[model samples]
Target: MKHIAKVVELVESKKDDYIALANDIWSLAEMRYAEFESAERHASAIEAAGFTVTRGVAGMPTAFMAQAGRGGPVIGFLGEYDALAGLNQESGATACRPAADAANGNGHGCGHHLLGTASHLAAVVARDYFAAHGIEATVRFYGCPAEEAAAGKTFMARAGLFDDLDVALCWHPSVANSVFMNATLANVQAYFRFHGKASHAALAPHLGRSALDAAELMNIGVNYLREHMPDQARVHFAYINSGGISTNVVPAHAETLYTIRARTSPEAIDLFERVKQIAEGAALMTGTRVEMVFDKACSNVLHNDTLDAVLDRNMHAIGGMNVTANEVAFATEIQKTINPDDLANASRHFAAALRDPRPIIPEILPYRPDVERPVTGSTDVGDVSWAAPTTQCLTACYAWGTGFHSWQMVSQGKLSLAHKGMLLAAKTLAATGIDLVGQPATLRAAREELHRKRGLKPYQCPIPGDVTPPPARAAGTPAARASQDVIA
Candidate 1:
């Protein structure tokens, strides 16, 4: 607790700089592996803070690692800078509207702008505190990218980036302030492409084996396979190509993207194999060749009760955000834009943690490490958890009913409420990092917990070794500029 106060003070003294960094990332709105400017900005900030920064790590141009301190336990801070596509909304606006100069047709709907900045700030403050107090701990910031639709951290973990970490701390922008104790689904995503010979429909209908038909059959088969799968398992797909626009010509090729999820990586991988079998059956039925191209995958979170308690202590010590009347009013307006069903859905998630239905949740929720919420979503952070003893907290950065990846969330990305939440998370992480450095026994306990939870099973990268990450797109491309008019 010696450096906790000093670290909090350091974070407060540099609040303006952190806020500016978050805002700049918000404006840039870079997507996935192409976060060139956003990654550059973070590298520059940490480099200027006297940390040695490594650019373009883990086969990702946008991914980097920054380190400070000389010895002692190694503490890692996980950060993400990827923005969602098709969410080009103006910040601080109550109503849904695109920004005047929405570049690249992307927005930080998930609040990763705040996520990366706060983690960076916490690392900077914790590093400074360790150096000043002679605590002898190494602090690192992992600038992970493509967390939105791609699992960038999964690849980073595969490359032995987190092998030396004693413990890892991360935080997310959420609707409530609490420890993210529940387990998330482990998921695998891939593209199934079918190929067939093309022929004129009018002249030789029997000669052509339509790839589109095969793709449709594959989807139907998977839908039926869902019933036999475990109740918790899920399969979702979308057609990337319907072969052709013209009905007069027989389609020669078609592509579909599928995402398979389960409670664990082994389960998800087994389910993925089953789905591949369905694709092969469809190909046989239609006399078409099918190719399964692996996209990406992330493991389920290895929840650590020991580290969660440390984070909870820090969160309670830091307290909650102090919302002004005007901020509450803005949050209320944002809530009005949310659908009733979405509001009810959010309430169910918060039922255990929150009793008051305030538009802005300004209180820290009780820690519930044993509660197992149904696995519905996934994050690249899960891979980091498996790599080391990792734990993350959630801070309120939006209205109670503001669902992620929506215009409502994007509208409040740069507001004062969001900034308050970001800074509070920074303090909590900084305090937690300091605690891990000063207390070796506590850190050891956390590591032991991780080992017990994992048992004898070793960590395996879901992505195949032969596969590499997709290349970053050029700045001026049509796909980069295409926009989706998602109003809600």
Candidate 2:
């Protein structure tokens, strides 16, 4: 409780500094694995806050770590700075106008700029609290980049970065403040490249074996297998490479980047095995050999009730963001720009499920009960959760149901509403860190729950074989697989 008050005061005093950091990151809006400026900014801020900064851990140039305080219960806060593509827009208004110099490119459409800032603020506050109160604990800010597709967390987990953590706390920018208590599906990604002899369609059509056919058949196989899979399993695929220019030319090469997801890692592995068999069958039928490159993968979240309770306490302690008149007016104007059907469905859903009916504005979330809504997405955070005791919270930083990669979210990265949400998150995480340091029984109970959920099964990466990290073309290495987890 004392630590919560201390963190509130610290955050209030450093509000301008935190806002500048968040705004700077919002202005940069760099894409995954290339958030150079954003990473530097966060590292600089952490250094200024008196934390020892370690840069480029786990082979990621932008990935870094900042630590403060002596050891006790080591607490880690997750931060991301990656932006979305093709969403460059002014911070206010609905039009897709670009900021003067950087036009029509990447922007912080998912509010990760705020995410990093809040995490950093929480870390700074926790560090200050330890200094003032002599609470024995280590505060760490994980400078995670490329959350959009380049799963930096997976590599960090694999490299034993988080294995020493007693408890890990993370939060995301969303439509409301709530302690997330559901499970995300485990997922794997791969690129199936098919090769065949190239030939002119008019003259040597018989000599060419179309690689595109293999890609199409593989997709078909996956689509048909969906019916046979468990109800919980989710299969998604997209065509990233078609290997051709014209209809007259017989394409010799093609690629299908597929992602297989399931309720858990073991289940996902089984499903991926079947998918690999189907790919082989597709290749056999098409008379083309295929090269399968393992991309990136992560496990599903194993919900922890004990840690969820701690997060709930923090969520209550920090309180929620009540929208004001100006906030409401801006939200209404933004609502007018969206598709009417989307607005109607979202309003209907929120009204039925939440206390509010207004689209782009979700209701206040309480401490307990699993959110009835489905997460529908996966993250490498699941891997870390499996390895250690972890709890995640969601702060309403954007408009309700704004969805990911939308101009609506980009418009609110660090505006007052987003800042309020981030401040709440900082308080929640900093307080949670305090609680973990002060309460050993809570940590023990959280670990027990994690063990019960996992049972005897060990954690496994959904990416089978040796999936190399994708090479950052901007970084200038021949594009490896470091950030290849993104299938979309």
Q: What is the C-alpha lDDT of each candidate?
A: 0.87, 0.77
TM-score of each: 0.96, 0.92
Candidate 1: the clashing residue pairs are none
Clashes of each: 0, 9
Model 1 regions more than 4 Å off: 474-488
lDDT of 1 by residue, 1-488 (tens): 55667877899999999999999999999988899999999999999999999999988889999999988999999999888888899888888889998876888999999999999999999988887777788999999998976888999999989978999999999888987766688999888888888999999989998999999999999989989897678899988889989898889999888999998999999999899999999999999988887888888888888998999988888888889999999998888888889887775564254555789898898886556563448988888988899989989999997898999888899999899999989999999988877788998899888888888466788877776877787532312211111110
| Model 1, total clashes | 0
Per-residue alpha-carbon lDDT of candidate 2 for residues 252-286, written as tens digits (9 for 90 to 100): 88887777888877788788878888878877887
Best of the candidates, TM-score:
1
Cα error, residue 350 of model 1, in Å, equals 3.9
Question: What's the distance in Å from true for residue 188, model 2?
Answer: 0.4
Q: Per-residue lDDT for 133 in model 1?
A: 76
